[model samples]
Target: MHAPPAPPEADMLRDALELAPDARVRPLSREPLGSGSVTGLEVTDPRGTAEPGTRTTGVTYFVDTSRRAVERETGFATGPSEAPDARVWLHPADPHLPALAPVAFADAASVLLARLGLAQSGPPVFVAYRPGRRGVVRVPTATGDAWIKVLPPSRIAQIVGIHSAFAHAGIPLPAIHGWSQDGLLVLAPAAGAPVAEALGDAEALLDEVDALRRRIAAVAVTHEARTGLKRRLDWYASRLGEYDAAFGALERRVRAAWREAAPTTVIHGDLHFGQLFQDDDGRLTGVIDVDTAGIGVPADDTAAFLAHAVASAVLTPAPRDGQVWALARAALRRWDDEAGRAQGFRARAATHLLGHALGAAEMREDERAAALLRAAASVIDQPAGTLGAT
Candidate 1:
């Protein structure tokens, strides 16, 4: 199936950037940012660079779709100019995330690295970035590698405190080397390979997760983190329905199955194989990105982990796909047998799966989004006990 048409803002952005008429504009990624959206693009000029004949390779650019946001933080809108009435602005200058430009660019980031006692050897490589929210950049340091987390200034203290609490409680989270006033947090790299790279025994992995959950429960913190997915169901439904009407029916079923559980324990708001790492001995040794670590329902974490496993099975390519599918099946069976409320657990898992589908749709990954939507439907249609039976 053909992907959804690019937003009209894309053309305006191309004009603002002043690319050749035949420049190839491909979307790298996209996500919702407050009142609108943020899209990352790769523009390749057919006419080539300063040298003749050789085509210009892709150049990255970000575009924000909210005029109100651009107006609110006009000082940060430092990219190419748009027409006075345009709703979008090309960004290195995200309105809500002023820290992004400095950290994403090498020269300015070097100053921040100096403060953390690290020398920048090369340009910062963005590990992850969510337009107006937070970003993680991998920086090459004199000693080795360090990661800089760019967050809203107000969130720095809360995240730092959470890291400290987790470390004091013996969780193997990354060590905070230092932080700057503008919300650049320098972190020592965590040890071990991500579980996504080397998924060992599924049951053994769960054992470690359960143990970690218990330890997290005992650690005290002031923040209360919740998934907030329940509140955003309508938004996801609406956005997805723009691509396919079936998403509307899917949302109804998910809402009907939803049940609010009391926040009983401290849980990782976003738990998945990617967030976990295991040592050479196949032991869970490192847990990174605890930004959402605080009070929450245990099932949210359980469902998140399971949902990601299933999504990976659907999206992962080739030989590794079979192995991941096996892992997903094992995880589903284990969680289903152990869950106190099987139906509720399935409902929550389906909700998480739909979230993955929404992200795929936003990125214009049509086929992948359709597959994920099917995965979600299966989760909702089958009994938890029989979900992974196939």
Candidate 2:
């Protein structure tokens, strides 16, 4: 298990950016894009003229193997220089996400925030940005914090309708303040601490999640959500196999054991502790990021929660790791007991674990990735009622 080699063009892209002689560029995050990757970089300048609090500037680069994709994209600006193996495109002007260019800056973002009757209290902090797909920006308001979700303009109505459906069904989701035709949706802050921080009583957490899932299922939504990790098992295997042959074998085992299930009910397509919030009293207070809420299998939500719990236990620090592991074991035992009755629960859980393994490997967290791979294998190899017997 070693760190993946740095992208061949990272240095070339850094030099092309033309920063101060003393400036340094460090990789912050990486996600797979079309035949290449979208990398987030932290550029630090010793001269101290960078973003507040952190004396570093954040930049995004899209490196693609396809020259046609680079040349045909007229939405974003590209660097003057090019890499030998891949084409490098810069941001603030992401071709796929048109709203990013305006929202990336303060003046432009403030002008957009004005539409919701809110003034920007500080520089917008991008909580998450997935190159061409979507971006979540945290905007500070005088009263409290608000979130601006940037999506493709075509998705605005569909997402707004989903939020409306969830609210009608009495789900504790973030309140939508306002939305624009250009894909910026302003939302009131979600309540309580993330479940990741306040994790306790695994059974109790499961109980709340069960109730939440039932409420979600009752909501009548027309849009059918895409299948979860089971559909991407082959893709994950292919990406991981590029690094090591063992992953190819692991994928074969997973595919042989996996039993695909039909989409039967409405679900929080991406359910994990991070997306859930609990109040001081340790009750489920809010659930954010309904971007994937629609019709899907019930097991997709359960497996998502289980896989993330196991991954967190594996990746987190000592004392917390022990606590999360205990929770995961308890939850796994419960799911294992039900696996006999639930058609594809075990297989779906394994697929989700493998997805996390791929993510860990992509980030060059090889040890964590290997541990997760083992976890996924265990889920598959262990008999129906003995998943957490160890």
Each candidate structure's TM-score, on Cα atoms with residue i matched to residue i, is 0.82, 0.80
- Give the per-residue lDDT of model 1 (tens digit) for 1-390: 245676565686666655677778887666555555667777788665444553345666666654333324533243344422333333456555557777888888888888777888888898887766788899898887889898877678888989888989888998788986677788988888888988777778888887877888887885677477665565567667777855677888878777777787788788888888888877888888888888887777877888898899887787787767676666666666544354366678888887788788767778888888877877765754444334
Q: Where in model 1 is the C-alpha error above 4 Å?
A: 1-32, 35-88, 337-343, 383-390
Against the reference, the lDDT scores of all candidates come to: 0.73, 0.72
lDDT of 2 by residue, 118-185 (tens): 87899888898776568888888887887989987777899999999999999999988898877788
Structural RMSD, model 1: 4.7
lDDT at position 297, candidate 2: 74
Count of backbone clashes, every candidate in sequence: 0, 0
The residue pairs that clash in candidate 1, if any, are none
Q: Which structure among the candidates has the greatest lDDT? A: 1
Give the local distance difference test score of model 1.
Answer: 0.73
